[model samples]
Target: MDVVTRCVHRESSVEEIMIYTGKSKSYVKSAISAAILLGMIEQLNGDIYKISDDCYGILNTTPSEELKTSLFKSRIEKWEPFILYLKYLISGESSVVAIRKLCSLYSFNRTPVQIENLLKNWAKSTGILDATGEIVDINLSYDENEILYKLNEETVNDTNVSLFMINILGENIFSWLYHDEIAELKKAILIFRDHPRDAIQCSGRAFEDVLRRISIQSGVDTRKLNGITQVANNLYSQLDSTDNPFIHSKLKNIASAIGDIRNMAGHGKEAKSMERWELSSTSAIAHLLLTLSTIKGIYSYVNENRYDF
Candidate 1:
């Protein structure tokens, strides 16, 4: 914290930080590196460093403990290794076991002992783990827990999916989406755990809404679009001839799947035995996430090259 505070006040080199903190050269260097890792500071030139722009609030006035903790938590939440560690803890793994898994999965270029100490220190400091290295009752929000569960289950096969989902939820990746579209997606994510069916419905609606917007922008006659599939296909057909046929075909399939899932949620098998058509909560949540991911990818491509579409 002292190193960060020093950097916040002025850009400092390693020697300057050592002089300001009255610490040994090695200790100052290590502190600066840790500060950079935690996103409290950023390297400027070769050796000089300053507080990160997002952390400038700590420049002059003393921040409250709540603000400090919020900053710490937000920064660490973006750290992949720390996120993996938290996922293991959420899945009932012991700290030792989680540390071992993390070590095996990622090469941190540090000794196991060093990695263990670093994780424990960050975990304890952020109140995520206690002194005993056990998870605390922090009452994680539904979406946060859902993300952790997905990361724990799916990262082994496709690590990028977990990270992409995390960024979608945590960052401003949806700026391309209109206000109402963004609101619907947020609604889906918010109720995905308790109201899985409704969540999937919301996700489907949001995705369909995007398709309709794109179709209209591309001069397609949306009046003839009967459902998401038609809307999606019409839009895809309008894509430039240079677009890859394989990608176009795959996107159409994904959009069609979203419509099919929405229909399953929208209509039950029979009024007498509605449960027959009801999807499991797990399946519904998975479908909702998949729909969101699909929307994210397609929307991003269209947004970047709107004129082409």
Candidate 2:
């Protein structure tokens, strides 16, 4: 039967084999049984059987030929997470400087230019299009310049910040900050944070929530989210790394620590000033401010390096 299957599928059958090789009937029966167990053929209604769809190639290909196949099973690999990080950078919840840091951490098949192009395509698809498309640009009395500058940095705080001005500032921060912390904690915070009363911590709280949700959705089979909890921890370590070429580790630690505090504030965690320089959170905020100041210098350095590139 095995010889018969090969003969019919590749031009050879059982009776033909018996005539050609003079095989005994019992030998033919044993061969057929072996072929059936191999799944090269599927039994149909009663005795009639057909070759399996997979068997067509199996019958033709050399063993080595089967090993060569495309590995790109899906698009939800590291690339998707890279795009998310880019959005975080653009939205001011994270920094563009993060790109270099992440590149250093992960080996990728894509170059920075390729990554940028990929992001350009994804941004267009997701309505992140051009930066200009982002704002309503209502031409309101508020200063767009100030808003952009404030967004260029999320740590900005001053007495002069107006109630409405703070509102807009908070929105940008919240939009990107949703992926900042562990998701459940972030979600619990959001249940309380979305209130009109919860403005300051909205950015960080929302950021953590977004990341957690993404991590959860990318199930084990999805590839990218398989080890995402560790990925988040790595991202946190880098963002909080003192040797980050942008800020000291102490400041990074403060940034991450205050991130939780900000969540507490957003979730109605009581009398939380959420303010940086309040004597209690002072030195931490100054170093944070110092980190921001260092970021500005790094921004300049990054651009200069980009141009040279």
Candidate 3:
């Protein structure tokens, strides 16, 4: 109909408007303006234009509430993986290794403590991914031109952690063990010299202290701590027995060693290679077993003396 409409539809322009129509320029211009306002035409230039967006059927269809919510949720889920990737990078690992780890954790079977242990385990080694989901680190030794690289030996792929993590494990183990020891050692003295009721309450308080300590580091692996976590319900059973030396002396040192091992593992003091495969997983298992043994020893004392009259 007019130059703008013709341009929109690819039809002929109103080239002969001035000569063919006696209507004034102002009237033609006003009609074109009104048409453009209604999405009938687009103003490209003063004289050139095209059809507006009224062509597509979905001009302003409103989305449903459920659709909007789903859109928001989808965005959030995408963000989680990205955030995890960023965390891996910020900690100084490579992207490939990060992806491997990110790929590893699904909030399914892992707690924060386990994740922390695993990451720290890898930080000392190499060939792990970084934040951007790319291979970024290397696990090369000091030897020049003599290191072999393997893909699966990266951080997340390693089945276990390092020795340094043993210290953390051992410290927690000792804390639990020491308190039980103190309770057994002081039970009689306090019960006889002061009030038996107060002794019982003090012993309860000692247990409460244990629970508080456990709560403080809620991220630590409870499974890795089974070794020294056992406690005899009654302390009087052991003061007259042969187990006194084991509990107060030998076990104390053993618990202390577990913590040291954990510290060494976490700090990268015990990272070494294996002949057939890379060496992060098995070593971690050994350290974990030591911790478990330390806890078991504590528990064994408790079990053996659990019914002691």
Candidate 4:
């Protein structure tokens, strides 16, 4: 918080950050790196940093503790190491056991005691665990149904997909996505339970917007791009031939699938004097999950090959 607050007023380098926070150089650097990853700050051209556009409002204001906690939780939802630790706790593992397991899975230069302290701090702040390292709750504001929804044959649940979407919308990843693109997905998630049909349409808009963003970033002339299918196909052709052919094909398929669902949700036809379009809450949830998953995949691929693009 101190680091963010200092940066909010002006761009700061590592030395400035250390002085402002009254911390050692190494600690300040780590904090900066974490803040960058969380999308709370951005490093500028000359190694100076400032508060990110998406996060300036929260850090610049006198944010309440509740608001800070919510922001922190959303930022870290996609962090694999923390998510793994949470899973261990949910499976009834002690804090010590979970820390050990986490160490085995990820390389940590810190000793077990240090890692335990760090994990405990995060857990407590997120309200998932107590100071004693006991489980407080695992839902993290989501209900059981939203977290545990079964999506056909796919093993991934709604919670996992929702976390990924939140990460994207929060600008933790794919920060280049526009404000409206992010807002559409947020609207879809917020209304899915009460307005499934509207949620589906919102999800479709978000998906299309993401594809268009990718196209623009890749230097495609989007002036002629008409719909989701055309934009996706244009992107697929732009991929290097040496890259994975399977992913290229899958990108097109995913975009087509999303476009089909969006069209169905937005427009229904009458056949045999009977209306043929319908959507349940479960179906909307499933579609939104798929949309989030697809966006994550595309963004991950883009990030990995950004230099090539």
User: What TM value does model 3 have?
Assistant: 0.21
**How does model 2 fare in lDDT?**
0.36
Candidate that beats the other on lDDT, 2 or 3, i.e. the better one: 3
- Root-mean-square deviation per candidate: 12.0, 20.5, 26.9, 8.8
Q: Output the worst ten-in-a-row residue range by lDDT, candidate 1.
A: 154-163
- The whole-model lDDT of each prediction reads 0.68, 0.36, 0.37, 0.69
**Residue 223 lDDT in candidate 1:** 87
Mind giving the per-residue lDDT tens digits that candidate 4 earns over 1-309? 677778878888888888877999888887887788667889998879998887787665456677777777767664556666666666678878978877876677779888788778877888877777787764432333444353332333333544445443322343345546756776676667678889999989988888887766766666777777777877877755465422356767987888887777887686566676878887887788788778777776665642210
> Which is the winner by TM-score between candidate 1 and candidate 3?
1
By TM-score, the best candidate is 4
Off by over 4 Å in 4: 61-67, 78-80, 94-117, 138-188, 194-198, 201-258, 265-283, 289-309
Candidate with best lDDT: 4
Question: Per model, how many backbone clashes are there?
Answer: 0, 17, 35, 0
Could you give candidate 2's per-residue lDDT for residues 1-309 as a string of tens digits?
A: 244244334333455445544779666655555455434455556544455665554443232322211111111111324433443444454333545544554555668665555444444433334554232212212243443334324332121122122233232222332222323222222232123124324334433344344334332122343222332443334422234332233333544554554544434424576443222223223222332332233223322322110
User: Candidate 1 residues 1-309, lDDT tens each?
Assistant: 777777767788888888878999888888778788877999998999999987896445455667767677666665667766776677788777877877776667678788878888987887878888887745543354545365334322222333334455332334345546655665565466578789788888888887887666655667866778888777766645466321256678888988988888887686676554666668777777677677666755654532111
Better of 2 and 3 by TM-score: 2
> Each candidate's TM vs. the true structure?
0.52, 0.23, 0.21, 0.56
